[model samples]
Target: MPAATPPAPRRSAPDSRIRRMIRIALRILLFGLLGAIVALLIAVFVTASTLPSFQDLMQKPNGQTVRVHAADGTLIVALGPSYGDWLTYDKIPSTMRDAIVAVEDRRFYSHWGIDPVGVARSVYVARRLKAEGRRLQGASTITQQLARNIFLSSAYNYGRKVREAIIALALERKFTKQQILELYLNRVYFGGGSYGVDAASRKFFGHSGDHMSLAEAAIVAGLVKAPSHYSPSADPQASVDRANVVLDVMQDAGAITPAQAKAAHPEQVQFAPEPKQNSVRYFTDWALAQLDTLVDEQTAPLDVWTTLDLKMQKAADDAIRANTPKDLQGALISMENDGAVRAMVGGTDYVTSIYNRTTQSQRQPGSSFKLFVYLAALEAGVKPSDPVTDEPITIDGWSPRNSSRRFLGDIDVRNAFALSINTVAAKLGQRVGFEQVANMAHRFGITTPINTHPSMVLGTSDVRLIDMTRAFASVSNNGNAVTPYGILKVTTTDGTVIYQHDAGEPRVLVAPYVAAEMTDLLQTAVNTGTARAAQIGRPVAGKTGTTTSNKDGWFLGFSSGLTTGVWMGRDDAKAVPGMQGGRNPAQAFAAYMRVALQPRPVEKFQTDVTLPEWQLEPDDEAYYGNPDQAFGNEGAPQEGDQPAPKEDVAPQNPDEIDDRGPPAERPQRQRQSDGDKPPQLDQKWLDGVLGNRRQPQPQEQPH
Candidate 1:
């Protein structure tokens, strides 16, 4: 009864009740807003604590400058302070400034530090894209980009973005809008190791940014997104395509008229000639890696002289690009007989990949490895004319067949090597001892592990292109071991010689007579054997090698005192259809050699080796019957003896005997009555081959 009476007396209007509730809600919202602002301020201060001072940030990055020069003292590249000069806002071309704004940030001029509109739009777009399983997009202003380039890394994460934003706001508070733009123009990266608009303009157009044309400005602007992908020196057409997009965006932003944008023929803009090959970047990287080992401290500037021939580098680059298929990659290493690496093309293009295949990659050398095998055999006094049976043979439990899947009954060592006869090589490895072959490789400067399996005679082990090039360079050098060197000298800005290459007396690894015999055999290989495609109208000696399934192709040889090795394969070690050493790799070798040897006079090999005089019976049709035959010009298939299939015509290109041969389908050959015997394995003979010479140690190569 008491509660009923109090309720009746205290009845209030519904409108008043609603007004009271609204006031309570307003207080809660105001408090929540204050808490959020305080939390944001704390985050900003914490991020700002890790930033460098504004004045310090304005200075160049903390590192000593390194100037890399070619063999002729031509400046190849500079490491630090790569900018041409600090360009003021007025000195930058208006077109370039406008193009950067149009492509990088549409609201650059209107925003203080962060654009709320851009942030919101980017968030919405990012959410929508995430729903479709796409990468998140960024909404960075020019100030933010400057903050990242100067202070932070290019990492993408909430923490990094928060730090980036804090630094961006501090930059806005410290400088005027024009000052910010000036700093950006002087510090942004423009690819090809260029920093700043002036440096990029000078590098690409051979001029300053102050005089850039509209199209050239657009090209430079387009590189901001991805420097390497749109590098003018690497891919001119791609730069033009990206520049056209920038032009369209600039026109849409009202920075230029439609007619002006349409008239901008970026496609016709001719870039300046690069003083160095993109491959030279690979060489510089290699040289730099050894710099730390050579110098105790890098606190001061440096001047590095490297043994890179621009002409030869250009030729090597062009040869690989012109010969290699689009989907594949190739590597080439060319060194003088003295072991100075003249030209090294690590891959087809350095911009797309930084891997130095010449020094880093280890792939099967295929039959190009036979140089060691034959050298070992020659050291054992097995003359090039010594007869070896090419009939099918097995070592241990493994049977090695020829790539042609057919064999000539008997052939001399010279033809067997020229044809890359696997059976004969297997027999020779067993007769000479596999350990001797491995010792021969190590003596020739091969540092990689060499497995002595019987199949090792067929190059079953992997080797680097540079090492293989050195092996052949030793042969070309008349049995002298080679240590491939790239850097000629290193000095400080004041000309203090910090490091200098020692061109010491050549170390003898193989006997001169054996090397001479091997060279003769290799010459026959390129002149009339599998490497016929490698002939450059001069005395050239090299071998062709293709691996099983065509996974790798190689051609290693020497011409005119210059030794080079060419290798073509996929990174994944997959098969490249229709690829053969004699076809692409040998062609590449020939093309490069033709240009490399142009400036030098043609030279002949040493022919003073003392050996027994021997001659082939004749080029009798009955003996050298089939041009496709591996050997046996004197013997043809007899009655009921089937002719070898045409598919069995070995290109003498690669390694391994075909594993697809049928045991019962083997072709029968006319046997010869020659009573020559194969070299038998004997301890006395082994000791005589090794002699009293010391085994050569693996030299530490500088790449």
Candidate 2:
């Protein structure tokens, strides 16, 4: 059937003008679309150029960071630049220069501004990657990248491509091939807050670009592909593998000999973590706070000079926060006698809250305030062997009981203060005059809303951790109370000194001998008393304090030159389960002191710094008389008796209650001393304080 169709030759048909017209229309349509795209690119460039200059993307020269040098300007923290000091081409190590050239663009030096062969290879790769739905990722020339990062608008479109090409050409024209390459090397961003080879060099290798090793240079060079993904500082082993790839590329390009490349690749090159850089973040924060305060928040910014030993700060914070328990949060403050806060930790993790709890939270002094009691007592000429009565004495129907409710018949004052005997302190407060004790605390820098009542003997008034710290620091400074000044010397970004710290002559609240005796008592507290665990091998002195219900736990201590305060508790005022000042705060205090004293010359407090003429002898009569037995001896069901908690409420460690409470809200109980007593026992007071068992016998236990 098919053979019959060959008979007639098909007539040559005339061209169909309609079809030609359609072809013509199609061509016009393609051209129109091309023209539209080109027009859009031109418009984008014109608009972008008029907008903010791309130069703003590069760093500005505001000098935000002022290099706080060591006494020798040893580059503690670079004050201004986002990265580090710039390095010129000649200063950059040849290994890095070659590695980057080899890895990024082998023909960078030989290409006539563009590498066609590389581009073709890249096009192949991009097409392959695109087939898998890739966005056509890079093989970008350093020049192209620099043009993007420093000059291009970064909109990621054809317009940006056109702009990048123009800038690359412009750069090529403005500088020699080597100069352009150098600029590219210096302008590329590296992860870890670094820009340029110089910054990347120091940031990754802990050295300048001039001294970078080949392995180190390769690591930095390889980072160009994906700084965040490939940074050596983030993952060293992975970076090393990438660096080895760069080394092989360099060898292939003949940029370095195989032997030289092999020699450059170390067994391993680790990019050191800048732990100390952020280690003193607390100090940095404190200084920055001062900066904000001293000058306008926006302008006239002050540069701060501090006695901050960043390395020591790191060590101190690291040690102190190491053993932090799950139930507790701790804060630390380290200061010199001159009121310079050298180190601080706001909380367990400052990344969580920048509150700087060390200087902010105002907590009760507990027994730590008892130091002032001893301080005032010694100034009043009380001897270490002085004795006070332990018997239950009613000061207008209010009886302040001992911690254990068992009083020794007779004890010396020194032992009394060291052992934290509450009744002995109450009796001593009566003799020393509670007003005088309050006045002594004032001279020692505890200027808070101190009630100036008998309770002041047990530190019931409110005082800040910073203020309380300053009080101890004052004793460390030989009884010279100085308000802590974290800002040492403030300067403009240009290094002009604007404000400096200088607290006047020492305000001696207690005589030299009196202060020394108190210091000796504090030392005993560490050696054998509540703060025993905080002993720092050296002759360090410390006192421990806890607010009621474990809301605040404290340990304040000092070495020969430095004083530190540590507090642990819940931020929300919820009790810390079962914490005690001597339990964890003391442990943290000792650890921090150990690290802080590493570089210092080991020394004890000056024997003559503040020697108290008055000795501290424990009062034996005050503590050791059993309370249960005493009450039982007086007959069990007296009409005016007290009911103790059935569950005992953990015995209310008078030490914990000594500090103004988190739970014992309302005005704290007054002391049996100073003619002031726990408020006159009205029926209402008894009902609330000791639940309504008017029969006055122990109530049913909670258990």
Candidate 3:
């Protein structure tokens, strides 16, 4: 009786607190399950809404192929829309399929497009590497990569990643696994300008994808990660190493035996010979770079008409190949007076080096920069016949010497320029403030930064060859500004004009008289100065530029209707023995010009001497009126009164005066601490009227 009563009281259908706790736990579990179910439904709906239809997938637009042509419609090269024969799933060998899966996506068959395990691992690695300050690595699966490659840009971010995941999941749900794999294999890039597995097999092994061996398949699979870095043609050993990795992965995945992988590891890969018709590859590359800028959006195949003259391009390429030194590189660019780039040779060989030196490289212009200084002086009322003493003088601590280390007592400004005299140029730069000279250069289309340093007059500042050529073109076109242009028009395959260049009226850069005078002076330089070798059978105006240690040599000149510039230098900036602007660069220019000007009629430069030559009157009072002024002492002697030679004058050769460097074994003066400051002219010499009235004393003679 006692036991029954206790049991009945104790049960009491459990305590109130325990019962309430159980009810609360059940409610929470039920709500959580409902929430999770709703979330999954929403995810499925969103992914399905974003999925491309079967028809949309089938009608996916192929990448547009851009075909670049010369002005005359000669095809230069073609890029993109490069697809091999369509590969079906059955045609793909198991080795090829498994190799891609093993290396690119380990859980391809098990995961639903996105692998959570792989994502977690990638997050951990990315965080660890970010803390160590390394470049972020990717954890993209094959499906994710395909989605980005086909539908999105290569930009990597959380937003893009999320979108990529959604698209990948949608893609997996819409297509069969085999179908997705077929699409990926057909769309993957395999380097050497190849776009698919079949194309890659043909390019690397000179065969079809169906006939590829296990090693070949592995090699092709490895290139999907980085085509250029693992191209068998460019770097065979790197391709082999990457292929070995793929083979190991395949063996681990049970697709291939360990013994089979070991046997294929040491096998040599035979690559096809690269095509020799890629002569215009560099030009095509440059044209492609400009395509986006020339057109807003390239939605279809484009027919781009370039400014290239095929005949001139061939001549320039041949000249550069035949004349350039074996160890050095060279570039040549020829353009019309209005800045239409006619022929451009970016380097000695486009296959060996893809850098466009004509448009990309910046090097010291050497004496070629003197053209700007002389032009500035002319604009400032300094005449070609004006007398300038070429004696050794020190500015602060820097004393620049001529190549011969011998100074001419007095010479006309024209002769000084023809001989590329460093001192006369420096003095002229000082007389007309360096700022004015820099402004004048900027007006003529030199975009490089110019420092207000005395040495800048001697061509110490670096400049691109194209800009320098444009500056000279301004002088050739009678003071008109020239803008260098390449593309003439771009048309889509549907005959719609995407871009058409309108050649506008040339802008005047300088006064017509100033241009004529500069042209005359440049003519003298090519006729009798360092650029003598650049002379063709016609009248030409050009300047020779040789940098210190013979590191860079340039010949920038213009004929009546065409302007061509040649640059020769080593890529490493190492000195080329005995190299000068008048040597190889001049010869190459002459060779190219001879052929380029063959079909065109020779035109003469218009000699319009409207500006009168500035005259200096010989008077003790008016000439020396501004004795305290640093410059603007206009009344120096005209040309008649010859200055007597100083006692310790050294004989100099006119031929050697054009050298930019000092004589062999002669030490150059230490550059002044105030080298950037303008060199001060001696007022006493200006007062003495260039040593005509009395003996002139230099402010500071060179040691």
Candidate 3 per-residue C-alpha lDDT over 1-703 given as tens digits, one digit per residue, 9 for 90 to 100:
5665444445455587799999999999999999977875577568768777654654435777888889899887877755677678899877889899999998999898899999899888988898999856558889998889877888877789877887887788878898889888878888877777888888888888876788999999998888889898888889999999999888888888988998885358777887775446666676678778778866677898998888888998998988898889999888898788888888987777778898899888888888889887776666666788988765444456666445667878876776677778878877776665665666677777876655667676678988899999889987777888889888888788878888785565555556777887888777655677888988888888887667788898998689999999998888776778878999999999999998878777654212223322323232222111101111111134232111121222112221122123222231223333222323343223222243333765555
Task: Itemize residue pairs with steric clashes in candidate 3.
Answer: none
TM-score of each: 0.62, 0.51, 0.80
Residue-wise C-alpha lDDT for candidate 2, range 4-75, written one tens digit per residue:
555776545455667788899999999999998788556555544553433343343342445454322344
Q: Rate the local accuracy (lDDT) of all candidates.
A: 0.78, 0.65, 0.74
- Candidate 1 stretches with Cα past 4 Å from truth are 1-3, 6-65, 69-82, 85-87, 124-137, 155-159, 211-214, 251-265, 268-300, 307-366, 372-387, 392-420, 429-464, 473-483, 496-613, 616-703
Instruction: Give per-residue CA lDDT, model 1, range 461-540, as digits (tens).
Output: 78899999999998898777788888999999989999999888656665565677889899988876778799999999
Estimate the lDDT of model 3.
0.74
Best candidate (score: lDDT)? 1
Q: Pick the candidate with the highest TM-score.
A: 3
Prediction-by-prediction clash tally:
5, 46, 0
Write the candidate numbers in order of decreasing TM-score: 3, 1, 2
Cα error, residue 396 of model 1, in Å, equals 10
Superior by TM-score: candidate 1 or candidate 3: 3
Off by over 4 Å in 3: 1-37, 45-60, 151-153, 277-279, 607-703
Whole-model lDDT, model 2 = 0.65
Worst 10 residues of 1 by lDDT: 646-655
